[model samples]
Target: MPPKAKSKKKGGNVKSSTVMDGLSTEDMSKDQLEEHIIHLREELDREQEEKSYFQLERDKIQAFWEISKRNLDKTKAELRNRSRERDEAEERHRVEIEVFWTVTGIHATLNFNEIPSTGTGPMAPQHDGTATKWYCG
Candidate 1:
């Protein structure tokens, strides 16, 4: 029988899965492998510490964002209330002005004949048959 051909894996190129898997045990001594393992473990520890620090920073930023968003919502609500108050006050002022003008026009017309121009009051207008003159105290 012919020598069996070397079996080949039928797939895409695959690398060894572990940190030490790619290293050749035949080339490296036991002490070298142990030292490499220690270094890899230290590097993993440092990376884990850095990851934790970044996670804390992200949490802090999220808290700040929550506070800022709450404040913004509160400010928007206050602004809306203030705007409503302003609109209501302006409407009341407009109505007051209209009523005052209406009452003034009617009062002036009705009280025109009750004034004695010469000696009655300060609001009386003096007439000399041609032009009317007003005097103020």
Candidate 2:
């Protein structure tokens, strides 16, 4: 067996070394080796438990992100549909206004306000003592 190398201790503090640097199992006493193995096993178990917890949290966050993305997509689609409907309604209203103006122009050109009335209905007297003419049509 090789000689044990001297470890450096700062300020007379004894810091326990977890790693065995080039030291064989035969160099350590039975009790020391067993204690080192137990410490290593506990550290490994703690690391594994922490990893599992982080994985669970990551999965939950991923699921929530997916649901939020779907809701956002649905909301965007609804907004687009409403905007298209509003545009169509505006187009219909513009066409209705154009048709109304066209019909009014035609009625004005026909001069339908000056239709002569028959004398069978009652007539009012004018300033000259003549019956006033009334347009009925």
Candidate 3:
């Protein structure tokens, strides 16, 4: 009610007072005041509608985020389980290798070199699980 507000526009050559949305209550007719009130109410309604739309969008995004977060956690847990399984398999393999070497060492110490080589490698057993050809034993 004090006065109609104006915005100042800056330029190199010309200065001006910018017209803003305001009512000149000093000389306003009754009809004008009513129209102004109606416009303001409509603007307020539009703003409230926009706010509601954004709130709904935010809720949808939050729900998606929660689902994605849960999926990520599940994937991480699966990876951890797989890593543990791999480590346990590696440890078992290491123990098996050690046992194989220890048994071979014992055989060597006991003069158990009973099989003859074929110059290619150790002879393959036949289908009956015996050497296909006899060798020094």
**Top TM-score prediction, candidate number:** 1
Which one wins by lDDT: 1 or 3? 1
The candidate scoring highest on lDDT is 1
Model 3, 19-61: lDDT tens digits are 3255455456778767777888999999999999999999999
Cα RMSD (Å) between model 3 and the true structure? 11.6
Off by over 4 Å in 2: 1-18, 21-24, 106-137
TM-scores, in order shown? Answer: 0.60, 0.57, 0.56
Decide which is better by TM-score, 1 or 3.
1
Worst 10 residues of 1 by lDDT: 106-115
Better of 1 and 2 by TM-score: 1
Residue range 11-105, candidate 1, lDDT tens digits = 97866534365766456677987887798899999999999999999999999999999999999999999999998987786677569768876
lDDT (C-alpha) at residue 9 in model 3: 66
Off by over 4 Å in 3: 1-22, 104-137
Ranking by TM-score: 1, 2, 3
